[model samples]
Target chain A: MENVLNWITANQQIIYIVVLMIFVGIEVIGRVPSVLHTPLMSGANAIHGVVIIGAIIVMGKAETDNYLALVLGFLAVILGTLNVVGGFVVTDRMLEMFKKKK
Target chain B: MELNLLTLCYLIASITFILGLKMLSNPATARKGNLVAAAGMTIAIAGTIFLYEQDGEKLHNYAWIFGGLAIGGIIGTLAARKVKMTAMPEMVSLFNGMGGACAALISLVEFNHLSKQLAANEVEISAVQPTVLIIVLGLLIGSVSFAGSMVAWGKLNGRVKDFSFTGQNILNLLILLVAIVAGVILVLNPGQPLLLYAILGLALIYGVMFVMPIGGADMPVVISLLNSFTGVAAACGGFLYDNKVMLTGGILVGAAGTLLTILMCKAMNRSLQNVLIGSFGGHKTAAVAGGKQQGAYKEISLSDAAMVMSYANKVMVVPGYGLAVAQAQHVCHELEKILEEKGVEVKYAIHPVAGRMPGHMNVLLAEADVSYDKLMEMEHANDEFKTCDVVLILGANDVVNPAAKNDPASPIYGMPILEVELAKTVIVNKRSMKPGYAGIENDLFFQPKTSMLFGDAKKVLQDLCAEVKTV
Candidate 1:
């Protein structure tokens, strides 16, 4: 944990650029008209489901005998997975309705 | 070597996500965009499970990981497939809540482990200040988003009613203060397990209180705000681990949610502070204060409505949450088609704050396979109303209420609405004379040019369609 802190602090500039890049990237993607707001909200909701990776990384470093960590990590994985799957599926369902019929 | 590979995989996945989000901005490619993002998520998940390594050791517990993934996948797929279009908002809230719970649980487990390490005389707890800040922020924001989303879900699906008492706002503020104090103490002394629990408990309660007083009218903004909270909390998880993919994904969602929230507020003409205070939209019984009885409303039979529409040169259909409740979008679309066949030009009038959320009406109408060009936004729709021959409002109320434009005392005043009264003639389909979710009587209902067709929207639309064939 200490070593990673030192590394992140050292690379703080990179983190700043990445975060700024994303914020600007979203702004540049242009205006999502009001018609697509719901799907956009749902799709963005799915993107945060990436938190599952954080759960795995945390649990991977824990001791094998740590039952508490295992249970919490497992549930986190399940919940995060649900968010990713359901969020994307529902968003696709909504977006499909807007697709131009070929 | 394994860590470097994992980083590369995450990088590629993040790029795909960016592309997916970009694609989502346009209607033509939105579905394909969702698929692209889903593929990226799949790669990120698989890489983390199979390739991630730390301290020169690969991850174990494949059984637990895969088992959880399979179960969650099935549940999510079924829920998404089975949810009716009308309930999409609540479904989104539920799924988003789960993400928040995951972020909160991650912080909880990590904090527990860190405290244990401190007690074992291992690493200095003070040395991990950034980690502590991330854990505290994640714990607080994640739990708030989770609990608050549950309350929002309940409110949206009609299982929960807004609850408020005198001094509730003060109580909410106090809870926030206590939670912040607890977070500070926990950050200063990371070994105190009790302080962490206190922060979590306070935040959970605050989430509920924060959303308890907001009424249905403001739910779109509330939902958007909570979605942003989940995003920021997820980013905290990313910061804790220094994972670039996680950070990028979190930032993307966080930024998108924030933008959505701002847009929602703008659509409603309400400030963010007014929304967070949770004071608007709860008054349902305020009397019409002008002390004069409004004109009696007139009712039009289904046949008359059909005749009027058949003879009109142009018809604009205005839909609201009532249309959604009756599941009438399909029938409404059928009516549109039938009217179009009669040489009556048909268009839809959509309010920015129509239905339950922004773009909610578009989703409903699109599900009924209504063409994208026919669905007009509030600004565009308002402009066309003066030229429209007949404005047919189906199961909508406040969005057409002239009160929003003329009556400053009305709760929804200053909000943009469809100028339905501008049309030459107006026909509204509703079950009764009851007020809408805002509980304000619509002045448009009593206008000389406006006549109501009383019944369920679907049934009324069906009867009107049959009568139109006769006409």
Candidate 2:
């Protein structure tokens, strides 16, 4: 555990960039025109569902006897999974209808 | 095979997420954009499970992992397939809340593990300040998002009414201060599990209280704000674990969610602070409803409206939440086609906040197979309305209300609205003279040139289509 912390401290600069990169990324994408903003918002809602990975990682490392950690970790995975799957699927359903004029 | 490869995979996934978001700017590529991001998430998750190792131990809890995934995936699939278009906002809120709860739980679980280490003297608490900071952030923000989103879902679902009393804002502030103080204490004393639990409880309560007073009308902005909260919380989890993909995904979601919330606030002419603290949806404004029409409103028959629509060189159809309530979008599309068949050009004028959420009307219209090109945003649509021969407003009220444009005393004053009044002839199709969702009378309904066609939007448009065919 201490080793991971040391590694993180060493790579702090990279982590900050990764975090800041999202803002730069959106600025480059520009304002999502109002017509597609709902889908965009919902789609972005699903993208954050990737936090389930954190849940999985934490659960894997938890001591087998630590039931509290295990339960919280398991529930986190469940909820996160729901967010990712439901969010993307619904966003897709809405976006597919946006067809150009025939 | 190495840690470097794992980081590389995460970087690739993050890039895909950004690419997907960029593609979402246009309607034509939004679906494929979602798919691309989904693919990136899949890779990020898969790579972490397979390649990530710590202290020579690899993750082996397959049963718990697969069980959670399978159940969650099934529920998500069913919900996505069955939810109505009008209920999309609530669904998004529900899912966003789930994601937030997940982040909070992760922070809780990690904090517990860390506390155990501290108690065992396996590690010094002082050495983990950075991790502690991230954990508290995730715990605080995630709790707020989770609880706040649940309230938003209730309001959107009509299960929860806006609750307000005197000094509510002060109470909310007090609770927030208590949570922040608890968070600070937890940072200083990292081994205290009870303090962590207290912060969690207080933050959750604050979340509920913060949103309970906000009216249903402010939900789009609240939902957007909560969505951003979940993103930042998720990013904290990423920072805690040093997972590049999680960090990148969290940042993207965070930035985009903030942008969305600001856009919603701008559309409504409300500041974010007002949406958060003003209780704009409370009972203060409830008494203003149930008043009689102040001026005379003229009602038009189906034939007259159809005649006006059919002979017009250019017609603009303005739809609102009432259109969705009547399930009239498809029928309205039929009216547009019939008018087009009569050599009248048809266009849809969409307000920024039209329907239940931003871009909601476009989704409804798209479901009816309305061509994307026919959907004009508020700015362009307002410009076109001046040259339009007729404006056919389908159950629309506040968006086309003259109050938004000319009345300084109106509650919706200073808000940008569609300029349907500028058209040569204005025809509003409504069930009756009742006010719109905003609970305000539309002055446009009483204009000399404005004639109201009273009926359910679906039935009225159907009758209008029939009349147009014969006219």
Candidate 3:
């Protein structure tokens, strides 16, 4: 219990950010109409591609001899990139179809 | 100095994500919103690649990093460019699964690093309890999301069939319990690498079982739920690495997905629990065993259907998944144009869950170059149906079924339908009387005012267009 409290105290800033962001997320996302659900989903999917940063950090820091970490990190980078690039491109395609009628 | 620059970049990325999501609420700014977010993502990635430092040392392994990025980027771009509009739901599932896989791999890699640190006696297990918990959670959630999404992708593409045995839901629950217990044990005892893999295995199994029995009609809700799972899993990664941008993005997606899931459930008038456990459309037993006998339905000729639509003062069209299957949106658009040319008002009625995904019908119609103003959502279209002279249902069944409103015993009883029976005449186009994606018989078919015009959606729309032109 003391450990947990210490951790919480040390990471108070992170906890605040997380809580505030959750509310912001709910408030902002609540207004999206059903028409844009799929595109918005795809867009958010792209956003989580920011996990690529984590993958990059891990891969860069792993020792050359740590094959397991290197391999797993490489795959993470690949999948994260796929999520980011594919998500944005697919969302763009879907949105393009919604082009205003001339 | 470098750390400050990196923080600035992350701040920019976070702001753009918020602005992008905010703008996505309206159609006018939606495309630009997506572009703005993408630009922010680029800035963040570049900053991380150039400025990120660990323990006073810069990152290496550029060859591996850039190579993986190149391969993934090329494959993602090509796949996204080539996918058919009708196959979009599965494509989304596939890509979301990839994200889940990445999060899981991140957990695995981090766990391996932690074990190595323990071997070197550098960090105490007591000090790393929180990190271990996050790693376990990321693994559990990410694995489930990945496996469940793969199954969803298969189901959407018709590569997998719904399979369930009696007590399967209980079995799923048991499996989930075990996985959670394993995760807890692994967190408490960080030395057991095998337990971690066991949790991963159990999570994957639970994910498959979780989605295996869900009826196809409920896919939108399931996809939304799983999307949120992936988001939460990604957020765990953010928590592990203290990446603010990742945390914000993941939270946003998690919230968006949860809200969308709730909206889909409400649209269908089903509770989330009911959607998860009850197999509404997976089997024919519930619909067939309890369903009241349907009377004979009358068929309408192409010419007569065309005449009714062309001469009607107002015609309202309802489209469904079968239309996309037949690749007939363009032809349907042509029929609408023809009807309008005859001085008839033509509009489309889009049920919220009309197609495979939410707003799927709108995407289809938009792709066909149908004017946005002419497509009416359910409430507006329901109001207009009363004044409509003809309601032409193309490749659609469940949304217009009166049983949803009238029959309490029906699985989809409380779902709000289009009230197409209110129109003067109703023409339904379908391949046959085979039940809709939900496997439930629509009572609206046997109504006196309703006429079935059986054919492929594309062929029927093409013939209807030709006939309407003559009329």
Candidate 4:
């Protein structure tokens, strides 16, 4: 419990950012018309693909001799890249359909 | 100095995500918003690749990283571009699943690293307890999102059937509890690779079981919920790495997805808990409701239907998943144009939960170049129905079902539906008398004012278009 508290204190800035971002998310998403729900969802899905950065960091830092870390990191990179690229591309396609209406 | 530059890149990425999501709320700026965010993502990635260093050692293994990126990028782009509009809901589910899998894999890799560090006596168990908790959480939630989304994708595409047994909800709860308990134990112990894998296995089962019983009509809510789960899991990765861009993006998605889930449930007049546990559209309800009698319905000839729509002052078309299944949106749009050319006003009535996903019908109509102004939401459409001369229902059932309003014993009772009955005439196009995705019998079909025009939606719309042109 003490360690948890210390960790919380140590990461206070991150916690604050998370809390503030949550509010911003709700406020922004609340105004989206139902017509754009699917696209908005697809866009959000793409945003979370930021995890690819973590994948890159891990794969970069892992020692070449460490087979387990290297393999898992490689897989993570692939999946994360898929998430990032696929998410954005799919979202863009969905949104493209919406744009021609104007 | 280099770290500060990377942090600046992350900060720029975070701001663009917010700006992008903000612009997405408006149709005119939505496409641009997406591009801006993608650009920011590229900047973040470039900064991380060149500027990020750990202990004065920059990242290596460029060949492996770029190879994976290139392969995933090709597959993802091809799949997204080639997918049919009708297959969009499942495509989103499939892509979202990949994200969840990535998050779970990150947790696995990080946990392995932590275990190694602990073994080398480089990290204290007490100091790393919180990190372990986050890793366990990321693994559990990410695995569930991945597995559940796959099942949802399969269910959406008709490859998986809704399956539930007696005590299934109880069993689901038990599995989840066991997984959480195992996660807690792993957190406390810090180095049990076996225990971590066991939790992953349990979470995968829980995810599959969790989605197995949810009926097709309820997929929007399930997909949204799972989307949020993936977001939160990704946020856990951010927490582990202290990456501000990742944290912001993940939290934003988590919040957005959660709100969308609640909105979907509200649109159906259901609570989130009810959606998760009730499995409202499963076979059990279908069997019980099957015994009820539906009075005889009248059939409308295509020419007569065309005549009725041609003479009407205002025509409102209600579309559903069946229209998508028949790939009839283009033909339906053609019919609308023909009707309008005859001096009849044409508009579309879109139910909130229509089709497989939220705003699904709108996307279909938009693809066919239906003007956005002509599409009316349920509340506005309900008002318009009072003055509407004819309501042309194209492959829609439950959304226009009177049972939602009138029959208390109905599984979809209390759910809001388009009051198409308020119109002077209702022409329903269906292949047969089969129930809708919810498997509930629609009482509106038998009403005196309703006429069933039985045929495939696309063929019927095409014939209606030809007939309307003549009239």
Candidate 5:
């Protein structure tokens, strides 16, 4: 972990510049077509689904001194759990809400 | 000149997300777009994990986190399995609420983190400029979405009335005024205790103001709109963290949410003003009395209507909330299969705002694993109804109402409708011919050739299918 932080510190400038370019590239491509948006967006939303997993990772990083981090990590876990459970249920329920009437 | 590989991976994932979005713009390429976006999401998660360093503190133990994940996964799968076809709207609303709530909660935590740093003089006050501002806005809007979406879910589940609160217009304006006052105070004194409480209070009020007035019929549209708001809020949060994936994901949501909001407006035949400002979300209070012009009732036996639909060469089945209440998708599916065996071309007409949500009809059919090709959207099948040998309408109303286009006096005037009135032999399956959720009688029901099949949708569709096969 220390090694990775040292590496990030050393390359912060370059990482910043490259990430900026990536943002610009994304904006340009997003404009060229519209239908592709849903797939891409869903992909993004699904990725955000990882916030729960990320919360777990954050929890793993927490120490006794980092009380705020621990609390936030736990909050993230709860919210993320809700996201995954509530999201799929809502999707299914939303789908089922349309059955034909007799 | 060194560059972190994890950051590079995040960039790559961002690119994939963009490409996936570009491809999704067209229906033919939608599947590919979805796959590419999924890939981007996977790459983003993988990259973030690699970049996340546990430098200052020991990582929390996996016990609770992993257990929670497992529990969530199991519950999610079970919930998905147990969901009825009619429960999708409420489910979607619930999910939207979670998404919005996540952003709100994240921003709140970030707020506390930033404030503590300022108190300790750990970071210069000026350092909090754009990031802090963006995060605050995210928190405010996310809270609104969360609260509003919950109301939408409640309405979808019939837990709340379709009507708005009394003095809804005035209530909305007062909430906006309070929220604006809160915002001003926050900007002037970011550290003030009163300002923080005001922001929380106003945000909660804003959500109720936004959602309270919307009618039940518009719950799906409201859910879609909130879904967009959540995206924008997340994007704002991304800006706070300077995260590439958050930015890209936020933009995707912004675009998707905008499109959905527009489509929803079209479905309701409403301008954004009607939904957002004019209390158009509420049901119409004043319905004209027909002044004793109520048409004579002509009820028919279910078996008799079934007999008529039995020998039809081509059939168009229109399913609505009636079918949902009866839990009749399986019977409808069976009826279709039976009709097909008897040489009838059975096709289903799906209204955009059918049942309780957008694509409600399609979802119902899809649940039955009805062929992907069997269901046709309104525009494609409206004309087909003309040539259709029999149009079996299963427990639907409002969407198929002809009066919307023809009768100016009708509450639904100028609204788009399914052209089921064009069908020659129309068979309506209804438990009773009550006014729809919108509180309007269907003109198509009173048409010359139209006959009501009184029974449960599942029973009627199944019995009709059964009898049709014998002929």
Candidate 6:
């Protein structure tokens, strides 16, 4: 565990760069087949649950000087999570309109 | 105490964003998406404040940040609560504009910080190079989004000239020139406050100008496209602050917006170029030929029309924009109640794009608490209309246009329509014989099986409902 921590400490910046870059790559290439854009967009909107994750991380790891940041970040994430959950449910109901009859 | 709780929160917030996005496909689940996404955003914002330490110099006007968020949140909530559903497209434009403006403002504040440090000869300020890039990009896109959104709002509200102003486009061009000239000044001296304000100001003007010429019928497309721009601007702000959440949120909006724009094009049966250059749908030359004497159908009094419908075995109601204009949803509901009581089977036939905007009729019907089962989509209701004893049209046209049947030259050609004419007896209520948005007369009004009852839609419908009860 100690050795792993040391290696991670040394490579933190690179790791940040790599993860951020992958997200960017997804953004640039995230084309839903022309047929699936509406569905895909709705699907992707559901994934916005990450905002909640972001808020939690900020609040839980807050320092003494970052009290306000912690509160604001948590608030933003909670609101963002509600949006994701509601949006996904709505999207599924919408997609049902397109289902084929057996 | 030194836990990686912030990182975990960020991961959760990101997942919420994804979930919201997935749920946004259907209107029914859209609320859940919003709730979840809002929860995620709250979490992300809180995390930023709590988890992130201030290793660098803190911002001086953090209070202003909180103030802006509060004010924006209040205004957004008020608009959502107060605005009519019909006006939702315009309201969306207003919200999107606000988002862009916020991004631009935040970038400006950051830029100011960077320049102040540079002027003080602080060696640490050298690290602000990426901040400079983000600032410029944010200003450009945000200004456009803000201005464009306002113009779109105006167009949807049908006050084009008020938003466009006299010679607005020309003035916008001049502003762009000034901004370009200011850009050179900015490049020559990166710390010029005057230049910063100038370029940002010009960019804002350019946004309005770009959106001004667009017409009302294309508002959905315009708003969706601008939504994409707002997203990009937000992402740019994310880049400025090195915030992962902002980047992700911005990218998602941008991608979603582009996709929406494409869908809007399909709705209009045109390309993006056509939408931009084709003027709007409301005032095109009449798509169907008129002025030739349409055969006159028999006119019916309220009493006679009521008698015909009261005893009908099956009655189908085809609603159009006129029903909306007349605010007759309540009356229609009343009429339905009366008819159903008489053992008459009643159903509402709706077109895909019936009203000015998509699903306009559906929302109006939903508001009246009309039973979902009673409301039938066009395809489902078409064949049923043929066997019906009477088909009552309450202030509707265009969708009943026979132009789709025989004339391929019609603008609405190839679009599917409800065959109200298929009914054994048809009653059409309109104030005048004037044509619809396409400026084409309704041939269904003149057919043998159809009867025209000219009057106010709501009042006439009420009269019919009362008369149907007595009959």
Best by TM-score: 3
lDDT, candidate 5, B228-298, per-residue tens? 67766766656665665666566556655566566566666777666665443124523452332566556
Name model 5 segments beyond 4 Å from true: A1-69, A81-102, B1-3, B22-32, B53-74, B277-286, B289-292, B466-471
User: Model 6 chain B — which ten-residue stretch has the worst lDDT?
Assistant: B56-65
Query: What tens digits encode model 6's per-residue C-alpha lDDT throughout B1-471?
Result: 322665676567666665666555444565566567667766766666555644543223345335434554554445455656556556556656655665565556556656766889783433554456557777777778778878887877777752334565567678778777776556556767777887898898788777766656566677667767767776675555456666666777676667667765665455787665543343444532543567766789999999999989998887777787788888898899889899999988877656655556666675566777777877779868888999988777887887777777666676567877778999998888887765666678888888889998899999998898888
Question: Comparing only chain A of model 1 with the true chain A, what is the TM-score?
Answer: 0.76
Tens-place lDDT digits, model 1, residues B1-471: 777778888988888778888778777777888889889988898899889886678888777788888889999999999998889999999998999999999999988888887889788866776688889999999999999999999999999998888799898999999999888887887778888888899999999999888886677678778888888888888778777778888878777788888777877777888777753544433554234367899988777888889999999999988789889999899989999999999999888778898888888888898998898888898899999999998888888888888888887798888888889999988889888876777888898999988988888888888899889
Q: Would you estimate the TM-scores of all the predictions?
A: 0.94, 0.92, 0.96, 0.95, 0.82, 0.75
Question: If the candidates were sorted by their DockQ against the true structure, best first, what order would they fall in?
Answer: 3, 4, 2, 1, 5, 6
- Among these predictions, the greatest DockQ belongs to 3
Ranking by TM-score: 3, 4, 1, 2, 5, 6
Cα lDDT tens digits, model 2, B83-175, are 988888999999999999999999988888888788889998778766887899999999999999999999988999988788999999999
Question: Which runs in model 2 stand beyond 4 Å of their true positions?
Answer: A1-11, B279-293, B466-471
Q: Is candidate 1 or candidate 2 better by TM-score?
A: 1
Model 6 sits at an interface RMSD, in angstroms, of: 8.0
Write one digit per residue (lDDT tens) for candidate 3, span B96-206.
Answer: 889888999999999988988888989999888889999999999999999998999999888889888999988999999999999888888899889989999999999
> Which segments of candidate 1 are over 4 A away from where they belong?
A1-11, A14-22, B282-292
Model 5 global lDDT (CA atoms, 0 to 1): 0.64
Candidate 6 achieves a global lDDT of 0.63
Which residue runs of candidate 6 sit more than 4 Å off their true CA positions? A1-102, B1-4, B54-71, B121-130, B158-189, B279-299
- Chain A TM-scores, candidates in order: 0.76, 0.77, 0.92, 0.89, 0.49, 0.55
Q: Candidate 4 lDDT, tens digit per residue, B1-471?
A: 999999999999999999998988788899998898898888888888888898898999898788878888898888888988888888888888888988898899899999999999999998888899999999999999999999999999999998888899899999999999999898889878899999999999999999998876677788888998888998998898888888998998899889978877777788998888865666677886788977899999999999999999999999988898999999988988888778999999999878888788888888888998898999999999989999999899989988889888787889889999999999999899998866788888899999999999999999999888888
The interface root mean square deviation of candidate 3 comes to: 1.2
Interface RMSD of each: 1.7, 1.6, 1.2, 1.4, 6.1, 8.0
Each model's total of backbone clashes: 0, 1, 0, 0, 31, 117
